[model samples]
Every structure is written in C-alpha cells, then in structure tokens.
Target: MIPGVMEAAVLNKPMDIELKQVPVPGIKEDEALIRVHCIGVCGSDVHYYEHGRIGRYVVEKPIILGHELAGEVVQVGAGVTNVSVGDRVAVEPGVACGRCEYCKSGRYNLCPDVVFMATPPVDGAWAEYVAVRSDFLFQLPDGISFEQGALLEPLSVGMHAMIRGRVNPSDRLLVTGLGPIGLLAIQAAKIYGVTEIYATDIVPFRQDLAIEMGATAVINPAKEDLKERIAELTSGRGVTVIVESSGNGRAIPDALTTVNRGGRVVLVGMPAAKEIPVDINTIIDGEIDVYGLFRYANTYPSAIQALGRSDIDVERVITHKYALKDIQEAVEVARTEKETSIKVMIYPQL
Candidate 1:
C-alpha cells in the first residue's frame, strides 16, 4: 500500500468541496488499485455537488463525486487476470451480483443488487486513486486517449437509447433537448442511418452545433413551434422516432405529440421534476411505443467495438478539457448553458 493519504475532491456538504488528503481505498481479492487518469465532469456529479442529492439518492454523508472515468492499474489483486499493473483502462463503475435473476438473464444492468458509482451514498472516483472491481475495468485500445475512454460511459448510454428505440435506416428522427446525451443522440441517430434528424433545444449554441453535427433542422422550443417544425421537416407525417434525452418535464408530451402514429419514443434522461403531464389519450390514439432506459446491459462490448471502428466520428463530441485540480471549475463549465461545449473531460494526471 502507498504509505500516505492521497489528494481528493471531497464534497463535505451541498455546494462545498475541498481538496483533502484521504486514505486510499483497500483492494479485495477480486479488485485492483487504479490511479485515476481522466474523470469526466458528469451532470449528476454537478447536481449532487450543487444540490446535495439526486432524486432519492441523498448525500446523507460526505461523498466524492465522479463516475465517468478512465485510469491506469497500479496494483492487481491475486484473483485478477484480465488487467495487470500499468494497464490503461476505462472503469464501467457498476458491480452487480451475479446470483441475481437479472444477471442470470443477461440484464445485469437492471440487477437490483448493483453498486453503481456516483449515485449518491456510494463514493465516486474524483480522486488520485480508486479501488475498482476487476470485472468493471475495460482495457483502452491503442490511440484512444484516456479522455475518450472516459466518454465511453455516456456514449454507451446513447447507444443503448438508440438500440431501445429500434432505430432503422429509413426512420426519420426527432430528438428533444441537445444536452450532452442529446448531442450524442444526434450523432447516434446519424449512425443509425436516419436520413433526416430534427433536434430541439432552448440554447442557441447547442442548436448551432446540432446543425453542424448534421441535424436536418434545429429549433428552439422557446422560440419556435416544436410540433410544427418537426411536421414541416418530415413533410407533415411527423418523425418516425423520438429520443428524449433532455429530461425536461414537458418533452414527454412534446415527444408524444410530435411522433408519427406508429413511431417509437425512447426515454434516456432521468427527469428531475416530480412528474410531467403526459398525453395518455394521444399516446393511445397514436399507438406509439415508449421505451424506458435504465443504464445499460450488454452494451460495453458493442460500445468498445464501435469505438474501434471510429466510423461515427463521436470524438468531436468532447468540447472541453480540464485538469483534476480544476474539477470545480470543470463542473461550473459543464453547468453552463451559455457555453457551446458538449462533453467535458477532466485529465487527472495532467
């Protein structure tokens, strides 16, 4: 073990973070010690830092916040074989009980007995080192930097959403909200061969970038009529698919109203609001298929393979980078709706 404590970004309270020296976590027989290299400043981490909780996961105690991460293995426990000392990898951050029915059925991501990082109570990886489960570590391919590796979490999420929506090459898609997930959704929709993609966002910067990233049309829901624009773009037939990544309370109804009679609607974002009014009558009338996403299962392998192909050009999605010491500033930057940036990565070793 390293004799002394390590520097960490500790959230002792809501809106309070300090650079403190904390003891490194111990590794078990099935775990490994990882020196965190890149930690992405995810919105959930910012939410916990700024608000002290996300939904039911209250920050009852001081917690370190970060989930999107990539690192180098510093030590491997006796039972570990897939990774060794000095291997660069991206940590999946979720450990599920293999004995569960969900795990046995290949739906491990939905396992009730799962310990996911950064979901409040559980301490996350915003530090110099972390003791991670060997099974959660994925080796980074050559030429894919730690920054891109950290991005795999969100990219995998978008890919899962795309898959859930049953995206087809002939489907016309409408994506509501261009936040990081929405931006990735736009890219993923293109990869799904959706010839026409309409993206809606309240921010002009994100709207412009959506166009740059190949959105057939970008509309500001506040400034433009969403239903009309989607209708006009799709020649009045409406979009064949809708990917709601914004988590905005009202987008649910917007999606229900904008999609074609038999279209598919996939929910990727977790809404913060207590509840949003949905047009049940309209959904029944249209016979729209709504799919809910809960993290991802059987996705990492496909995500890594797709990353190797590099045919999707998802690398351009990362818009900002910061050092580990600058994590607070990185959080603020990512919180900004004014900035034109999409994904933000924190390089811990830099």
Candidate 2:
C-alpha cells in the first residue's frame, strides 16, 4: 500500500536542509508515481542549497532539490499507458509544453515554459515517491542499474553537446574540462565513432577520470600549456572539434585557440560571468561554428540505449553515495570537495 505521507529533504534556505514529513504528491491523470531508488546530486542542486538561486531561479520557499533520478513505478494515473506499475524507469526531468513552437519543431529543450524538475519552482525527485509525466519516463532495461539510469540526465547533456557540435567519426575532438559532463562527452564522442579524443582539466583526479572514461589523452592545463599540448597532440593542426564544458571564462579563450580552422565549438557549461571577451577575429577568420547547448531534448531514449550497452558503464563516474537522510553531507561534498568528488548519488529508499 502507498503511504499518505513520506519523508523529504527540503531546502528551507541557503545552507539549511530539513527532513520533513510531506504528503506524497498526487498525480495528474497523465502522470505516474515512482518510488525513487537513486537520485544524483547535481551541481545545480548544490548551487541552490548553497546560494538559494541559479541566475533568475531563486528558492522562494522550501523545495526538494534533485532532478537526476530513476526508480520503479509504484502507481499510474487513469490516463497513463506508457509505463505500468513495477516497471523500472528513468525520469526525464523537463516536461515541456507540447503545444509550443519549440516543442512542435522538436527542439523542446528551448521551450519557454518548460517545467524542469528541481529548477526553483518545480519540486523534484529527492523524496521516496515522486509523481511525474508518464511520457517523460523511459523504461530501463535489466542491464541498466538505477544508478546508471539516474546518470542518463547528465549523459543526455553530453549527447546533446555532440549533436549540437555535429560530431562525426573523422573529427579530432577536444573536450575542455574533465568534469562529469566532459568525461561523458568523451564517451559520447567515442560512441559517435570519433577515434582521437583529447580532454583537459586542472584537477588530477578528473584528468585521470577523463582517460578512464575514454579520452585518448588527458591534459592538465594547470601544469602544462594547453595550446602547446593541443598543438603537439594534433601535430600543429589543432583539434577538429571542441566541446567547452568547464564553465570557466578563462578556458573559453584558451579553447578557441586550440581548435582547427572551421572547427565546431559547442558550449555546454554556463559560465559564471554573464559576458566574457572572445576573439571575434579568430571566429571569423577560422570560420568556426559555435553552438550553445541548453538542457537536452529527445535524448532519453538514445541515452538509455547507450548506457545499457555492456561496454558503456557510466557508473564509474560515481564517487560518493548517500541516503536521503544524509543529503546535507552529500550536498557539502559536491560543493566543497571539487578535487575528489565527481558525481554524488543519493538513495531515497535507503
């Protein structure tokens, strides 16, 4: 039997998390109730817990903050038919309004009124049970664990980055940042048949993770000159494609110099500064194509298929795990332990 109420980790204010008893969310006619098994601690979740906001989205009230989640369906609404009770599934956090122009064009990630889970106003899947749109949930095969299911959210971003950059088999890729997204981008590039993949990071741990995740070589930009390294690696021709996931303003300019003429640059990470200086001359002269990536659209199905392959193991990115009761520590680790932590996961049912 489903309980009427459940325990939830709510962010009351900046640096404050409370475990409170809340009524289980009632589902709409087209929704399904999921018993959340695993939820990944995202960078945005930590930012909200630490500063109470990300850009314009502010925490005006206490809210549950987790978006990367996967679980089993506990119940389904009358109109729901996509998934049934007892099915393990991965929930796509963004529920875009299908009537919008962006959604009609199949670019729903740009939906102006997208209700993304854990993005300020929308309460997310950090609780024992979460109700979500039935269509947004994708069934997870037996080969894919709940942890890998949760990771599909970030992995979708990596996949979207490759899509935006128009990644091809012949491309020599340069991923500037070995964070979760950058490492996953390497895997995505490899999946797309790109053979020569190079990655960069300032931290030694992430650099090591880059190689483990499928990078041909990892460059520590702090210790070595990134431009010189890229030049030597590509035999002075520079990389054919660049995916900038570091979100560091300084790295943007450096990455621009390492790409070959007519290379594609996909900006996946949001930089702290609203505006940063870039070389317009390089972009014009080199005829470089730059693409900005928002959240992913229509990537859940492919992400599931990709992660389900025996060869693609995204679980390796997980560095820490915690039960929902210990969400405070989980957020702290993701926030302060940048050097050691990559992805922190939480099990709400534990």
> lDDT for each of the candidates?
0.82, 0.90
* lDDT by residue for model 1 (1-350), tens: 46458878888898788777889888999999999988887878888888988777899888888888888999889999999998999899888887889999988889988999978678888888899889889998888778767877887777788888999888888888888788778777766677788888888888887887778888888988888877777777778888998888888888887788988999977877778888898889889999999887766666766666555556677788877788777777777643676777877666
Model 2 Cα displacement at 332 (Å)? 0.6
Clashing pairs in 2: none
List clashing residue pairs in candidate 1.
none
Q: How does residue 146 of candidate 2 score in lDDT?
A: 93
Q: If scored against the real structure, what TM-score would every candidate get? A: 0.93, 0.98
Q: What is the lDDT of residue 5 in candidate 2?
A: 99
